[model samples]
Target: MSTLQNFDRRRITGPDKSLPPVYDSSPSAADPLASPEPAERAHRSPSSVRPIFLQTGLIPSASGSTYLEQSSQKLVCAVYGPRQQPKAAGAGYSDRGTLTVSLKFAPFSSSRRRAPNRDAEDRQLSLRVQAALEPAVRAETFPKAGVDVFLHVLESDGLDALVCGAVLAASTALADAGVELLGLVVGCSAAWVGGRTWLDPSEQEARGARGVMGLTCLPALGTVASVWQTGELGLEEVEQMADECRRACDELHHLAVKVLLESAKKRLGRS
Candidate 1:
């Protein structure tokens, strides 16, 4: 963690649809976070899903690599690290490893074409993704050398769920590369919509959300790394949403572990 957290919280307010408001002024009456009470979780009829799928060696130049797709989201991650340390006096580490993350939205990934330059939205998301995985990574061990994690969002169905998908993808890729982690980092997003909570919201459902929450968990440790909530909600309502997010994360972890195993089998030519 950096000293940036100690700085005065900066506020930004604009009429932008993509940017979150500096201060929530949409009135608690209509605010999703400010809902009167938590709604029951939505359930869908069980269907057959492969459990997990893995893409190996996508980044030829990287030390370790993998790509994964869960439901509607698709992500590709490459891990490069435990390598050279920057020739600086006070860099990251030398013995262990540092994780540096770069997240980008591919041009054809979105319904609209992505711009080449990193936008404010991209910067915000990259920062969040990095923060979500920090607790699971052991940075001090690397000393001056840092591990590089790259994420390419191959698609965004219009849901504000990029953080969740990216977090899981990044962690899965690291695990696939055999990076030592405190535990698996699993992430999922839930949206409060139509007086009910929806798990793994589609692009449309996300945009209609009252409050969108993204949660990351360390399943083996039985701990939560991060819980991000935007929009408005009452205390009890927020707690309920948190519970839903936890359940969703559990599902994602199952998929992630399956992917890790598949990745290993591919490397070993098991099947």
Candidate 2:
């Protein structure tokens, strides 16, 4: 059996990497890649090479909320509002809505303990997450109010893939909040494996994997929203990666739509 000590953090994040194992068992830190395990795994066969968990309605205070956990990697998202303007006086509030995203990783959320607040990595994730979400939201409808979306990463089995999950979590939270969306935004990723692209590669896989890309899209419009890639790949390979990413978004959108509708009904009953 490989003990926890056998996996070196540096090696995992090193320039040359390999496949990170994927699991769909517990929602906790057992594998660390799966945070809150996706409830739909039973529908997917054990043999499916690409495994992911899709979940929603996990946050209460936000206009809406959603949680996605794959293996031990986990993200909890909350959509706070079309609420009052922030502290910036005479701040440029557009006819479109303003979105402010915050990303935080709990100290115990990773294999190595992290600090309590936003570190450099957290700040970067917030920026990337915002970029991924902005295109799909129709901000003009909310006027001066800003929608505050929070992403709390409880665990990160594969650091790179977890960021992709954060993008998905934020988009779902936005739809759940009912913030006037142009279309649902969905995110997915592909990692370089051997001579081919690994769709949704795990952390370990990421270490050995050469290049990775995180893609976000507007499913209804059939348009690309954001494309983020790290490392290297050929132009033709990149196009193929985008195509695969769009497919992932389409599948994820179905679950997002179902969750948002169910959440809206619950909110109506409570109100």
All models, RMSD in angstroms: 11.0, 10.8
Question: For model 2, how big is the CA root-mean-square deviation?
Answer: 10.8
Candidate 1: worst-modelled 10 consecutive residues by lDDT: 41-50
- C-alpha lDDT values of all predictions: 0.70, 0.73
If scored against the real structure, what TM-score would every candidate get?
0.75, 0.76
lDDT of candidate 1 at residue 49, scale 0 to 100: 22
Candidate 2 TM-score to native: 0.76
Q: In order, how many clashes per candidate?
A: 18, 24
How do the residues 186-246 of candidate 1 rate in per-residue lDDT, one tens digit apiece?
7777767656666666555555577777778888788999888878666777777778778
For model 2, the local distance difference test gives: 0.73
